[model samples]
Target: TSERILGGLSEQGAPVPQGTAAVISDPVKGNVSEADVSGAAGPLPKAPEPAQIEVLTNPSAGQAAATPVQNISTGIVSAVSGATSERLSSAAAEQGAQLTLEVAAVIGDPVRADVTEAQPVGPDSGNGQSPFSLAFLVNLSGLIGGAAIFFLVGGAAERLEARSLRTSRTGLWTVRLLLGLAYALLIAGAELWVAFGLLGVEHEASTAQVYLFLALATTAAASVTMLLAVAFGPAGIGISAVLNVILGLVSSGGLAPLEALPPFYQAYADWLPLRYVIDGLRSLLFYDGSLDAARLEGGWRDSLWFLGGRSEAARLEDAVWMVGAYLVGAATLGYLISLVRDLFARRERPKTGKVAKAAG
Candidate 1:
């Protein structure tokens, strides 16, 4: 007996077998063909009865006059069979023989999705804060005022001592204080010109208010430097640099947030005039120079004058009054020190004369 074989190899190189020979018979067209078969290797086996064999249909071979439904099924089946045959042929060449049946899904409408993208927030978003502006307006102003006063007053102190004209008098101190105030005003004007006129930093305060704020800040810084210089002479410049420039800026929270600083620096920031100046600058730039004392909170860290907490209003008020107090207090203390030194010198001179007369 002969056996039918699908013209292909399995994945594992095994031949595909059909139990008995079959014919592809298109019933409508009456087109019939026998499938390929292989003879038995040795003795002939008994053949199956005709009733056991089944006829497969080749829907693709039907006549053109077939119904539309039949034609569609024919096309689909023909494509699937052609694809399957190619796969089988390749498999047979590579390995042995194979046969498979697969059911395909029906075609449907296409799928789509709507996607959204994200954007980054920038300075224009109202949360903007510039480190450069903070440093320039606060830190730089303090340092510049300290240095300028040191050079101006420190040099004058040295010259006065050299000419034996270092006298403690109210008129002299009044003139010196006036000079410092005038110089501070000039520095404030220059800073404003650079920040607003040149660099174009936006601000909520009027130019006059900003000018007054800057002038007061500079005067406070200069007064401290002047006090050191008048009391300690030229060596006070070094003292001023250490206190106002290095220690002051580090403690002022201008270079970094107060929360990020050490406990000591954070505490120290509350005492420094620079911190008040920085807070005031922030208020002027962002908060429209708001002076509501009700705006108090802890993190501002500008001044410790109030017990409960700090605020933009507290900062602005401190910038004007507290810093102004420092200007007056330091200058007065420097003057008193001068007066004490003069008194000591007068007493020593009288004692020296009495001792010289006794020796003669």
Candidate 2:
């Protein structure tokens, strides 16, 4: 209508429609009739009518033009839904009422969640979950405790072997095993006391399970270091420190998760006791010792494929058992090597005796 009103006026003045009984007095032309105006202007070209938009009742009609409008409408609806949900959530939160915010989306009425609103893995801290807490567990329990046990056991074993006080290799291994168990238990206990008792850190797992994990980790480290010491002497201590402390710390996946590590570290993540210890601690401390809870709450299910596709229960069980395996395997291997050394020493002693007799 505005287009008609505006477009109808021109340089020749406003053109009257046909059959309009209106008098026109023009400055240049003395008087003008409606017929004269219409005839002169060649039936005053009619203004083009605005297009009337109809509802897109079928998919076949104006699909190209409808697509952008449909997208815009969908976006508007989604934004409004999100805002309304946020408002309701805020209101409920203020009233101390618990509510699950249901977000509405455009596609087939599917719901979309705002993941940012989800709670984080560990305790609610101002800065979110710190890597420092994880590092503290891995370094204190796995690296420092493990390395200390290694040196304590290895140094004692070194002194016995140096003084030739190890009469029976079997007896020596038995002593080492007993000593390792004692030291591991003490280390695990002390560390737990420091963490839970002194630091006031909270854990959502059984104390026995956490203590067992730490003990097994330290025992495994002691077993491996004792094996190296019995086989390689003093050099074994350096090797143990490098393997269980330096390399272990890097590959532990405590500071950075397994997926974030390089491919080589990811490949060997399962073989290392440090990785399992850290993973177990994380599960116990924050995830209630349940792999499913960790996976669901921590968002590790899809990303961390190194879990070997085991069920949640199986994975949680394996985390502890694998460290125990390391302890048993290392201890057994050390025992076997001691047996072989004793056998060779016995054979050499008889040959040397016979040679000395011939010389005499």
Candidate 3:
């Protein structure tokens, strides 16, 4: 009816039928005319809109566009997870393999480790294998060698006075000792790796144990350095320098046996730490342990006597004695030097007064 009224107005500027109520209905609901309805008829329910039907009919079009993206995300997550799991599995397997290899390595070195029990099968045989001797030699020499070199320098440095030499009153001692110990440990460790890892000669139970041995050896070397410094004072540094030279040249790493050097160096072989260190290293590598049977022989007896005590569990006594000796030696030298300084002071006092009185 509203449309008819609008149509009449557009066509001839005329009004709809006078006093007639206009009825409007949706096309699908069936078109009702004004003649069918009375004036008392209430407004008919509003017709359903076409725009609402169009929206409801195609609600999933946006979802359809997003389907490919959802699928791609799921696929990517699955691929990344699968790759990560595979890599973790492979890494675990590799670590297991390394552990197995290490175990196998420990099992294989019967020749170097079990020297007393393990022997060559054929007719070509050497007699009397000793395991304790081997281990004792290894453990003792590194300690003794480091100590000897440290003190020998002190004994020689009793000659040079610090004032005469154009050098620092006291140099960087802690840094020097630290460096020395570091170098010593470095040499020992590298050689041990070659001996055990490459040559398959020794079996270190763990890296921790090796570290412990290094710490002990470094400590021994440091103690000796302290003793030398105390014994000779500033001159002791010179002693350390000289001793370090000999130790570096002769007893360094696999370069043991000073006798093997030039002919002139042969006498030093017996007393030098190189031979002892080599013997001690062999003991640690080839024998049972540090306090083996072979270490009881010769100068090693003194080392044991000095280090040993009444109880088997007692700590090393030699370290105490050695340090004490270092202190006593230092005190004696200091006393002598003090007297020299006092004498010089006394001599310089009177000559000036006598010269002034004569001139007046």
Tell me the whole-model lDDT of each prediction, alpha carbons only.
Answer: 0.52, 0.53, 0.36
Residue 310 lDDT, candidate 2, scale 0-100: 43
Model 3 weakest 10-residue run by lDDT: 52-61
| Ten contiguous residues with the weakest lDDT in model 2 | 32-41
Query: What overall lDDT, based on C-alpha atoms, would model 3 receive against the true structure?
Result: 0.36
lDDT of 1 by residue, 206-252 (tens): 88988887788777777787677767766776787787678876776
Cα lDDT of model 3 by residue, 1-360, tens digit: 334433434364222222222221121123211213223323325432211111111111112212222232333333333333344334445545332443333223211211121212111111111112222233344345445544554344333434343212123233334544565566557645654566454332344444444444444444444545555655664565456344444433232222224544444343333333333333333332332312222443444465442222212222223323333443345445545645665576588768989999
After TM-score superposition, the amount by which residue 333's alpha carbon in candidate 2 deviates from its true location, in angstroms, is 0.5
Candidate 2, 165: how far from true, in Å? 6.0
TM-scores for every candidate against the unseen true structure: 0.53, 0.56, 0.30
Which candidate wins on TM-score?
A: 2
Q: List the pairs of residues colliding in candidate 1.
A: 8-97, 8-98, 9-96, 9-97, 9-98, 10-97, 10-98
Instruction: In model 2, state the lDDT of residue 190.
Output: 85
TM-score ranking of the models: 2, 1, 3
- Per residue, candidate 2 scores C-alpha lDDT tens digits across 1-360 of 222322333332432322221211121122211112111112213332222222222111112222332333333334333444444444445555432222212211222322221223433321222223443343444434434554665568678879866565766677778877887788778877877787656667888878887777777777777777767876876786777667776666544445446767655655566666655675676566775321211223343445443434454566666666677778888889879978987888889889999999
